[model samples]
Target: MSLLSEVERDEERRAGARGDGDVDQPANAQELAAMSKLISGSGLLDVREGELEVQQRNPNSPLHSVKAFEQLNLSPKLIRGIYQMGFMRPSRIQEKALPALVADPPINMIAQSQSGTGKTAAFLLTMLSRVDPNENYCQCLCLAPTFELAKQIGEVCKRMAAYMPEVKIGYATREEKYTRDSYSNHHILIATPGTAQDWVMRYRIINMAKLRVFVLDEADVLIDQQAFRDISVRLSRHLSPGCQILLFSATFEEPVVEFARTVVPEAATIRLKRQELTLDNLLQVFARPASIDIKYQYVTLTFGLFGLAQCMVFCQSRREAEVLQKRLQSDGHDSLVLHGQMEISDRASIIRRYRNSEVRILITTNVLARGIDIAQVNVVINWELPVMRDRSPDFETYLHRIGRAGRFGKKGIGLSFVVDDTDERNLRQIEKHFCTQIHEMNMDDPVQLNELQKKVRK
Candidate 1:
């Protein structure tokens, strides 16, 4: 099928043209406005207290969740920055982990929470609370699986520590160049495992022995990679005996959890959130794919129907994203493409614009999948199902991809394309793994399309 065979090339112009500043809009614009106002006033309302099972390794000190940010007794500057950043109260993860995170004598903890639950903010606050801004030689360290994630964490911490000017945070990303004099004096360090390991082991610029709190974000992914796990273990050994360690991930398979226990031994584990085996607020569906052109057609149709609230289409490769963005734009859909290969500055700019609703659709790989929150995004499409390097289904990636939608517990739609028998098998594996049935949706059916429209409106 030709890309333009099903629809006229200039039909959008012939119909009603979108005026300037009218191209981007949510499913319900008024509703989004109200939600934004509420968020600015009371934090994200959707992430209210939910189910969390707590366990204390030590029976003598029973840790309880704190409902208010003040209960943790954070620094005045930190509290002022938190409120100014529009976080009026603690998130579900914050409420559960703050007490243990900001506790006296610093606690070693393993916390698991799904994407968008404020895990980054929770841990950043802990890092800030632990650091002594006056006399700093990298007192706190946070390592992410990727440099982009490391940069994202740095930005969040900067916002949280805006009122505390004396606090300094440094990055040791692959692209970053830092000297001993420049990097050694920061209060906190955020970097990728390989780079941080190099700085600590080879260059000896980062004195890990001085670290007070060491955080491993995206712990499951880190442990799954042999190279990263090895470096992480070596780094753990270098930390001060009394240094606190925090490991956080969206989903933790049992084996990974066990490995985490070894790293943060006797850790006060805060399973504040389970893997979220299922996203109750997200509508899941799968579509059968045909020719390449036909797949593009279905994607364009999807954007027209439910994508005004914005959409993220995940591609398996960078070229795939470029191809899809080209096809989508040719069909009169203005969109953006983001991939890990792009410069970090470009990636950050795209994410910020997407969050501000400047871009309606973003085509990319798994870079935005983990722990990046954009409230207006309500639709996520797996242009191709994610698979591991060994050709097996990557269930964790699938969960994170779809999680981009229904963010902050809002309603969302997630669709996956099954291109061949292999994709079909992968989809089946994902469904079985999550224990959630994905509807086989036929966009060709008029009644089904109407129902989807109604769901979006609802």
Candidate 2:
């Protein structure tokens, strides 16, 4: 049976046990209405199948376009670049977002879609399209949270803007090669918030007056941190008055959404439903170890059984990640540890090695969670549950962590470890927050573990 069907059956049994014929209400009114319609005996699987249909039928949405890229009236050079990039047609997000983004009388946009859903290309296209090719100065600025992400975005921008040779691109990360004198000539700039702010204020490297489109690649994560948020707000203040602002992320909580609304006034928004936020193809399961020591043993055994080409093990802290990496190495597993504390060049090199399949296992904190897209990852192990400073479950972090595996319609597995009551409680909270079920697994049973791995590998 499908996973959603299993969840629905479990929910029905619980509702019957409670002696309440009504289904459990969701946390908010919007969710309540959506769930009421979803569980009305039509089946959860049907709702999942029809999610895109429902979204398209929403008359108020700006993302319902059915036109082709050529039909969008883009320049021939830009169209050729897109075709050369191997995109025959626009993805759902591209179809919906491109129309509004490239429209005249420029409008601000706040788009939230799942990872690997063409958000990067969507904004990059906008940035490239907005740049005046004749202008030899910076006209578009894209800010990401990390130098790695900024460099990655810069690479994609370079590829997409290949045919449009006049559109110069610059990287404003710490390792940027441009000197203060030559940095101002690029038409597009991809940077981290801190570096972008310094370039604007201290070095006078970026020409804020000529900036046309300002894009925040990972808006949710960028806005959540106080330091990045302050620097971003300050950077925005220096942009041209008519600069079009665009914010994009895979997930946006209520506070972040509110913040986006405040910063980008009257922006066009494209949001996915909570249920739709989690990729349906991902197989999410958790293992309950009897003790903390057993958790490491279980991971070692499971890694051997799966024989995965590449996997990412997420830890709650850098110290824990380092410790786990050492233990895995001692167990003869080839692994690398990465966190925010490492130098940017080191982090970038490690990511490149991991992406090239030179490293089979990567143990990291949340640094690689949000926007880094590596498609070869077959499994994701949550060595520790994601939580905030107050120790509450961070649902968005969990989503992004697991998202690193099942990318671009690929099947993958997310295995979370529950060591004790606190960890189990946090996992349960995450399951409830996503309105999905995370099946429990018996790590001690080799036969069952093999069967589960087979299913995920298929």
Candidate 3:
């Protein structure tokens, strides 16, 4: 069974064990009697892309099925494009967000889903469905916090528009020049907010007269840095009347939601309480040592023994990333270094080598932890736990780090080395924050170590 289904079963068992009556249950029977009710009192999260239908294991509860493309009533061309992209399935966010987008009097969405849960595709499809190909006035403008993420959205939009004969996609970033004269023929503009905002202020190039949808991909980051006021709302001024706004991110905080509400008045809200696993099919393991030195020793040993599979090691700082890359190379490991401080070309080269499996292990910082897809990454190691304003690493960052390994439900492994009690505390906090149960196996355990060795041999 799928992890979601397993979680549902666990919830059911928990509910059954609670002898308390309706008073203890969060929702009343009438509330639960609708087409479906959420398992954990979180709203029904829609899932698409599979043959599964919404059905109840027992009559007392209602379950919402993940809506497939067939149920979505998407246009033939759109469906063909989605199929061409090899996305024969829709993610839970897409399933839930699409219907809500199409509903008459569109409901605004603020989804907290994992990065690779196909979140980009979900919003892009909605944008495409709402846009008019004939109207080439930047009908939809999607903003991302980082240049990399903006480029990613642009790429996806291009692919989804492949089957659509007339759609044109243009992206503007600090790196790419998309001026008024450059892409006036385009139908959609995917861009970093900083660059897009710069253009709007300079050329007024983005014609809001034809705009219909506005999307903020990494809303939390935008708000966290206090950059949304200058980045997001500046573009909001270019929106046509009654434009539907959507915000999707892996991490959700109260401040970000409040900021969103201020920008989008009269917006309906939906959040996925389950916090969709971005790293599905990933095996997360932690190595605990008596000290930090021992942690490094074990990691190096693991790397040396397993050879390599084009891995990524995440560090907390640019300096640490560089140092780790040097250390690994000195130890006779083929590796590269990347951080936001590096030139864009260097970053790109590192990414290319890593993707092509030319580089065995790439050391980087959080800049690589978001929206960068590397399919050949069979392993990811967190050399140092990320520091967040909160006590734990952002759940989204954790997912994104591990997500590098597994793509399209392929098996992958994420190893986090816990060197001290502080690391253990942080790990526990992360697991608790996400309500995920991660199994702990000792690298020192003879049986477990031997089993792992045997598997590696195969």
Candidate 4:
């Protein structure tokens, strides 16, 4: 029930047998990274004297899973805030993570859980509880990979701290004007890596030494990208020695896991089993077009039939996304485009509209594969199936792409487009790995399309 492709699962089993799981190295790339780390002493981590330390979780020991938020001995005010935010009990990750995160000693945590599982809230509570709102100078700091995600974290933190008027959350994203040449009173700082790095190392506005809790949201992406990985390492060097470090992501390839250990070592760890991340809530299907251009036919037909439902159509390139959006718009569809090339402000504006349901279709690249949360998104179309940089089927990205639609236990439709045998092969591998069936869609069949409409309406 894992989300990995068949080939990656085989690699995982072999790597696990050897106890080395990290991401992207050699062309088979999987094996190269792990093998190199065990040998070369390269990358951010200076090879320790002993081989990389492995902290195995105790199978039976409970770190304290609570039936309710009150069981955690949280301040009554905090419990009220949780309930105010509509959280009644602890989610899987929250239950195991809250007690460890808010403990007196403040344990470091490395958590790998499915998306939409309340990881953001769990950490925000720990951060808010740790910060002294009365004497604020950016006591708690969280870094996400994108401005959209950083904003998302800020929104959740604000809601959870709504009752605690003294707790303030500030952003360090692009164009954020923080006090210069002066120390500020903001208690919580949410930002992306580059801006956060500049704020800490370059501008000297917020002192890293004063931070009590440091969080890296979507840590796998931070660790996977070289520029982000470098900034993360530099940021880690600036964190107060006592700062509680928390890293959370849905997918952690092996090398990224190794780097996570290097950055936040000897930490409490919580991970959902592989089966938990499968596409149980998404109705998976694929449509093969006679040619690449025919993908537009599928797109128009889908929107033409299900015009009211919000959907996200993922493309492999910015150009394709732009082209699709233009085509859809010309055809009288209210669609928007979100890709990496757009200006930050434009990107933020588009997401705001999409979240507010001002638009029905969002065509984009992998940028929206993970972070943004819009409950209205009930359909996901893989206009271009996700693939790794090396063009192999991207098991993790595929999981995240479809995950955008079937959010948090809601049923949704995930349709993938295959223009050639290569895509068909990749889709089959995805099916084999996740142990699920993706029925071939027959667009010409009126009855089948009607059934799809009914499923979506459900």
Residue lDDT tens for model 3, 62-148: 333345776775788988898888777666656555676655455566666544466778889888888787766777888877776
Report the C-alpha displacement of residue 140, candidate 2, in angstroms.
1.2
RMSD of each: 10.2, 13.4, 15.4, 13.1
Cα distance off (Å), candidate 2, residue 124: 1.9
lDDT of 4 by residue, 1-458 (tens): 12235686577556645655332121222122222222222112212223222233443544455667877757778888888887877765675678788887778888874345667788999998897878858898898877766876788788888888888788988857656633367889888888888888778767888889999887766766788888888888877779999987655568758878778866877765433444878888888777545767777788766545689998765655776788789888889998866554566577767776888889887766765556787788988788765557988888988887776567788999777777888999999978889999887779999988877677
Predicted candidate 2, C-alpha RMSD: 13.4
**lDDT values, one for every candidate:** 0.76, 0.74, 0.65, 0.73
User: Clashes per prediction?
Assistant: 0, 1, 3, 6
Clash-forming residue pairs, model 3? 47-66, 49-89, 49-90
In terms of lDDT, the best-performing candidate is 1
**Model 1, range 232-295, lDDT digits (tens) per residue?**
9899998888999999865556866877977898787766444353478889998876787677
The better-scoring model by TM-score among 1 and 3 is 1
Pick by TM-score: 2 or 3, better one = 2
- TM-score, model 2 to reference: 0.56
Rank order (by TM-score, best first): 1, 2, 4, 3
* Model 2 alpha-carbon drift over 4 Å, by segment: 1-64, 177-181, 203-205, 276-458
TM-score of each: 0.58, 0.56, 0.52, 0.54
The weakest ten consecutive residues by lDDT in model 1 span 21-30
* lDDT, residue 402, candidate 2: 91
Residue lDDT tens for model 2, 262-369: 667667777765543355878899888776678777777767766586899987656567778987788789989987677555665677678779988999877767
Q: Scored by Cα lDDT, where does model 1 land?
A: 0.76
User: Could you give me the TM-score of model 1 versus the true structure?
Assistant: 0.58
